[model samples]
Target: MSMATYIGLNFSVKLNEDYTEDEVEIDYVFSSEEDRNVVKQKHFTTPYIYEVFEKDEPIWRMNEDQKIHSPHNYEKSKKTFLYLCHLLKELLPKGDYCEVYICWLGEEVEECEGELKFNLNNLQIEAIDIYEKYFIRIEN
Candidate 1:
């Protein structure tokens, strides 16, 4: 048996802000939890982000030459967005915008099981890169 659910998500990442000071801010927004685990897991990385700042910055930070190290924690849904960020860093220069629009949801396919594809402005990145994409559960 196979099933799939389309969930709506919008992610906007601004890299190397051109403001008076250099800053990186990621905006996360999602609606509803198709199931309970989603709610418990917390779709957004806002909490973990703060934790990184308060506790440690090594997980995701830039060095002297503007290089990012270990910027992702391998969260399913969030992976698509982080993948967007990792790619945007390469194409976009300082103060560039990376907007990811997630529109497709797949499940139980092939031997891999699940996969996710997202639109990164003009570019597209799939979760198959890490094979830890988002998967949902449906209860009757």
Candidate 2:
């Protein structure tokens, strides 16, 4: 019989004002099927970064220095936001007129009967709403 497993996905966004160009960073954790059973038990984490631009000019960028934490970690969330603002300094070429937005995605997983079960959640929408209050809109 095959064992069941669960997987989860999470992400966060931030704005920085100290960068010369807009940027984005996405990170995820996934299970590997190519590894042996013992090795497969370990999850793999992947990180990606991209640039955000508007009208051929950088508008704002995400701060890669920020660390991603579990949803229960409120302190890290605050730090993430602060780091994002720092990156925006240089990314927002439009000066104070430009808006910066940050978002995150989260997922949960469980193991059952030699099988893998996964639950996914998108926290980016909530993050967008929070930033929108500050007059920032996450680019679709």
Best prediction by lDDT: 1
After superposition on all C-alphas, the RMSD of every candidate to the true structure, in Å, is: 16.5, 15.9
TM-score of candidate 1 to 2 decimals: 0.20
Q: At residue 25, give the lDDT of candidate 2.
A: 27
lDDT against the true structure, each candidate: 0.28, 0.26
lDDT of 1 by residue, 1-140 (tens): 21222222223234233332212233222222232124223332111211001111221122112222333432322433344345445544544332121222222122333433333343333222322223322111
Residue-pair clashes per prediction, in order, are 0, 39
After superposition, which runs of candidate 2 have C-alpha atoms over 4 Å from their true positions? 1-72, 94-140
User: lDDT score, residue 6, model 1?
Assistant: 22
TM-score of each: 0.20, 0.25
